[model samples]
Target chain A: MKKMGKERPGQPGMDRRDFLIRLAKAGATVGVAAGVGYFLHDPFGPRASAEKPPGVLPDFIVPGVGKKIAIATGGGRIKAIDGAIEALGGMGSFIKKGDRVLMKVNCAFASPPSLCATTSPELVAEVTRLCFRAGAASVAVTDNPINDPESCFSLSGIGEAARSSGAELILPRESLFTEFTAPGSSLIRDWPVFTGAFTGVTKLIGICPVKDHHRSGASMAMKNWYGFIGGRRNIFHQNIHTFIKDLALMIKPTLVILDGTFTMVSNGPTGGSLSDLKKTETMIASTDQVAADSAGARLLGKTAKDLPFIMQAERAGVGTADFESLKPYRVSIG
Target chain B: MRRAGVLETCIGVFLLTLLAVIAGGVYWYGANPPKSASGRGPGVSGVPLGVAANLPADLAPFGREETFDPGTLSDKIDGKADLYLSTGFVELTVRRFAKKTDAKSWIELSVYQMRDSAGAFSVYSLQKRKDSKPLNLASSGGGDSAYRTADAIFFAAGPKYFEITSSAPGLMGDMKILAINLVKGQPRSGGLTIESFFPHKFLDRSTISLHMKDVFSMSGLDRVYTAVYTDRGCQVTAFISRRKSPKEAEDIAAAYGKFLLENGGVAAGEMIDAPGAKIYKVFDTYEVVMHRGAFFAGAHEVDKLESAKDVALRVYRKISEVVR
Candidate 1:
């Protein structure tokens, strides 16, 4: 066996023992300096108390492939939903046989559907029926509302529609959320996420209504995922554009459906008066959430470039802001 | 010699271990950032902490008060004031009073303390609409304006903006009473003196406004006071911004001019008489911007270039005199 500090012959340097001594002395001096420097200037000390941990991506996500968006206009909610989804291929294209489907619907407020603040019950019911007809084993409807969950679901008429359509209305309970970490995100780290609806669910669908948001410019399909967040998530609004883009990165849904039957022109996300709403009678279905929101913006007389979130999401490689380039299928349902 | 060698080796190992410990500490801190305390707290900027005590108790109402720092303001307004966070928002206090008889019969009072009066006015003006009914309140002046809806009253005074909302009918009287009390609690200060610099001739009093954040959708311009005027069958708007320094004012004026040129406006050959003022014609309307001392003023949407320059120069002269 060779000695511990034995040097090989023909090597042009000090003996192994001498080299080891010098290296140890140099390392010791550097390490002591580094330790003192760390004490003097702790670069990674506690951050601002208001700063939140990064948001977490969903554990199970359905990848989007060859995504297409379809816009159906000139019809009631049910007809528009049908025409839009059919144009995107069909219900069978998203929901497969024996799949457990989870529908994330926007029930942000307890207001009735006529106020256009929440998703229309007729549209939710029709989509539930379509999923079941496509051979989905179970369809669960869920939302973490801004108002009281039970009242929001019940008064919004979404509860009755889900029950009558043979779907389970999953109300978010305190125990249902789990702390999740979204790695490599400046915002939304170690946040509470509603995990109850994801149990045994193989497919995910997002249903949202287009409306003018006082902060985010507009709330569309991408904003629909805000329902999955729990706790004091409103703090995310401090950087509304980044939060929206982070949401797009967090959830990868099978399909995104934008309900524009009655677009809220102003004072929205929670419109109180009927005068704030306009009957656009439109629906957009797409596999790409960013693309769906880009098209939905047009219904509110805004372009993709007008919203910071849409541009940010596009730049983040989530989807394209040039939604027109996708050559969406346009239909008129009478 | 052998003992010294062993001592050096041990010291090196000890230092290396200490460095590792420090590195681990940093990583742990980065991984787990501190979180704000989750509950109601005292008011910011030495504002009264007990908001409920200041309110009338005989209203037969139950009250709750919450104070929010700039980072957590979204919690107070449910994200409604997210846009204002960029404008130097400091803190906010929200007091909610609800009658026991009906949950819908409630009053929500919010007091926002910004970095300065300019920031407060910016948030106030952003929320104001042209259709709202103007209210004559004791605190209305110096970049302060009050407007009311059937159930809501919004006003700004000094470094604070107030919002009083009620779901109950016929609460305007109560709102006014609350406003007077709120003004009493605030520090007395002069109104936005910039309003006095505008020429009263051809000025429309009702149209006078101070845009806190941006003017006409153009960014980098804050604390801009604007008023409309009727001149020879044409309507024109004159705006002025009092910046911290002349250089800063000049930069903003230049930025506004560049914005106009980028947005389909053409630079005109005839310049305004004021030092550093440029004229532009955009969409059949003339626009002019100028800077004097710490004051930046401009006129936009006039029918003719000469008329726009005339308004711009007059406002610029007035601001220069005030600065002098």
Candidate 2:
């Protein structure tokens, strides 16, 4: 009878205290396990980073660092056109006769050049003239837009200048793209991109307008590479900074021209009101995307301290932020 | 009086013993319930259920350029994928590799139920291969979801996939998920399918394989089961793999064939026997397709094993329709 009581079916023991204690223990265990499990599955974990071969990390870092072209931050005088060409060694350095030169501009935002959110027409025209002067080849300007392609180009000012300067305007599609790999990026492994536009080019120029972004706190040279992405753009917002670095790792641009003629101080990448526009009148150019962006940030009265991404780019050895290291040549552009 | 005290002590001991047994039973039930046959339900939102799940947790929260939109889940394991928002079910999908040192200890798969502030159903957190002993392998490669996210494609909304790679200094494993957009209980485009898809645009010239060739002859599916032969055979010369699930096997083959075709191999033809068997062949020493219910017999070359295993998984991925 005693044994039967011990094995008693429903209420094995009449006391509820022990049941409560076990429940508490189970809850605690599950909670700890949940935390550990969640952390272990983090995307930055070893398994994720292990996917890309070691060759990928330095691959993005090399051109990013080597391409640092510094513009004059002294005297407040801006050299928008000559500064860009000169930093890339006067166009003769890269463009040769019969070489196909492709220039990728950000026409994704439907805004004019004065807003400082779109690539300036003057910047595009100067690059085109430089390419034509350097070679007996074709120079084409185009972009993959998040909005209507033609409208973005025509209204943004890149389309007219590109056509007049003897550069063809191409729309982004599958035909323009090819695949490339990010060697050591935990986020990006290998992906397809605009191949013909990016590959085998004697000279490639990046024209990005400095703007404020809700996500990265700022949009500059590194952020502009998002336009070259072939298939998907929304996923970039998932892990924005790591991917920005990854994209920076892939695009080894010869010149990163910041069109700071009309700086978008606050709301940007698409500023509706003219209130966000400020007359910074100073266009910064550099072979180092990091340096140009850093200089541009300083002009806006914000230092690299506020932007974690700029600091990150600098740490990754993408470019120089120290104004002292760069030889600035101040020239007035009317 | 002493006798009475002993009797009372016995009853108290009996009650404690009974309580322990009941508590243990409850613990066992909570820890190990029969897993659902088809696994947990999909994301209630229109997003793909397993997009992030497709990539290893370490390879997730990847956003291209300046975009780190780690889908709708913002817990950081793979960098900073912290800005996700959704009102439906979300989950993590962890994947385990068969060749890892601690593969057995890791979570083969797990599910977590999520709810929004309204206490409504939100995300189904699925974690695959969640636990494993620390590996001693050197660094090898990373996953695609992070890079894709970094590049700004919402891969978490694309397809359910995973990969295990071992490179020079390290070995790696990952799970990737395709985002799901639920439409009246159906899935959006780009989700996984259970049927073999046409590799090339033309279906008539596709390769096929079989086991127990005579069995297909008896079953009258021979017209459907095509056969081919190559130089290598078994585990040494050919490809052999054991998958954890039918879905996994199918996914591997599809992805492998895609890789091969993309890399420059042509689908010359296919061979078959019983669904799964002991013997297998390598058509080009670079590729092999195993039918359902097959075990590889020998070891294969190191260079070709990866590709061959991938093709085998692809075959398994699309093995749902064996209609007579």
Candidate 3:
């Protein structure tokens, strides 16, 4: 063990908090190395490609892959989840062991599996299990439920699913929020947020249900981050598109998973009527929140142009809108 | 008889033409009243006197009286004491300017020392009350000076008791008279005798503002003092209390600067040129202020805690003088 006073090469006056963050990152890096599947590399720079063919690229630009999404389905079940995952390499491709993994699942409504108001419990569980298997040291599954958390989690089956999948459920409460200063932001400067276990964590994954929203037209990946903010949620509703865009800039999630298996056609992030459900038989996964939401919007037969938040998120560089670069991999499941 | 017949004929001829034109003019006037008449008042045609004669003489003070008797007033009348709901999420209280029929004498300003359950009297309302109607003047535009009510009371003895009241709604329980004075003469009418004094010089390190704490959220300085300054004389004289340690007082002095710089009270560059002075520490303090200069050879330690306190007071007085 290194002495506490022995500072890292570049650190100056590193306090206990900084030391802990670095220690966690180091532990995660070592654990990922031991897992020996895919490797974690800094995403801020151009990544060196693995010894794989062009057809089975280890990585694709996050924004490019999000625009058009595809979930493999065959014989009424998922046949190639691992194949789709392998296409972009493996879990090790993005995350490392000991990384604080925060999964944002859709628990917006108190409806059963068939209602489509929330992401299907099966999809959420699969994502949770995959993240744990990927060497995530700590997995925290959370969502800001519009309905009561207990009812929403139970009826949507997310609570049980997250538990069984080895993910801790983080209920949205004021106690979980912490103050963050966003410099240069006009509407919000110092605001309170739940701070998706991501700040010091190695990776952040957005697991959101594709649904229609009253204010911004669509509640997709970018809008999902709004749940993390507390104190003044109503202020965001005043100008939702700008708020969503600003939130996307703030969140900067590592990956986006659009649970399009059952898309809410209307009256959501909380839907009630039976006619509001639409079965897309698809799951959109990408690194770009904008592109993932754009594809999710398209699943509902709505264009990115129709969803103002998506356009704003895209304009803010949260994702891309151009369908050509989306690079969708439509796989068949069993 | 011939002259009377001619006069009758002229009157009849004039009446016939005038009647035809008068009817049209009256119709036009009915449709549009002249704009000048509309501009004279609120044009509502009713005195908005608000709640009339319902409030107890003690709580509402309907007529001019030496003292208010709370027992006679209504217990919980709606909108008591003529507090008008104002725009911008605020309400304004009514203090009928103590109508002194005599021109020479002004009403005495009275600072009500509201007594809490403990019986200690303070000028401000420390707690939130639901519906108690005490003799409190409500106000809006949430600024409170440290001794503004005190000063208002100080100058009230002369003649014009600026019918002062708390800036909050509802009653303030039982209140006793703390201090009384008239502000000599109306400062507006060549009467500028009323002055604030602070014995210390360092107290002027920060800008002083007279405002309420809860309303402004502890953002502004609520310090008050008075002193006359000459063009060539030192303006930085300050005072402090004897109780606190010199080091502690110095830290307190630095706190004023910290607050000013950190909380947008004053620009960092602006503090360099502000002047300083030394004086005896007591109830109030004074300081000399310079908008663009240095002071006290870079804020050193003075002799005693009292001296330090005096400096703090002086700083406050200097700031108050500059602000005033």
* Per-model DockQ: 0.21, 0.01, 0.01
Candidate 1 interface RMS: 7.7
Rank the candidate models, highest lDDT first: 1, 2, 3
Clashing residue pairs found in predicted model 1: A53-A188, A53-A189, A54-A188, A54-A189, A55-A188, A55-A189, B122-B212, B142-B191, B142-B192
lDDT of 2 by residue, A1-334 (tens): 1232353464455345555666787899899978976875656522223344443211212232344454533232225566645655666666668867777777765444545567877778877887789873888787776444664687567899898888888776667765455655665544555665654455666787777665676778877877776544556676787777777766777667777666766534554334456667676766777777777786566877677667777778666667447765454544
- What does candidate 1's lDDT look like per residue over B74-137, in tens digits? 4434446565676678887665565555654556677888787766766666556445677767
List A-chain TM-scores for all predictions: 0.82, 0.73, 0.73
lDDT of 3 at A310: 74
Two-way TM-score contest, 1 vs 2, winner = 1
Candidate number with greatest TM-score? 1
Q: Which stretches of candidate 2 lie over 4 Å from their true place?
A: A1-79, A83-89, A178-180, B1-324
Query: Which lDDT tens digits does candidate 2 get at residues B1-324?
Result: 012367779997999899789979976985664321112233342113243334333432211111112242221111112211322334443222222353222212212222221111111111111121222111212111211111011111122221121111122223222211111122122211211331222222212221211121222111122322231443222323334555665554555555456655565444343243222233445445443432222212223544444434434343423322
Residue-by-residue lDDT tens digits, candidate 3, B133-195? 232222221112112321122111211222332212222121112211122122221111112
Top lDDT: which candidate number?
A: 1
lDDT of 2 at B112: 21
Better of 1 and 2 by lDDT: 1
Report the number of the highest-DockQ candidate: 1
Please tell me which model should have the higher TM-score, number 1 or number 3.
1
C-alpha lDDT values of all predictions: 0.75, 0.48, 0.46
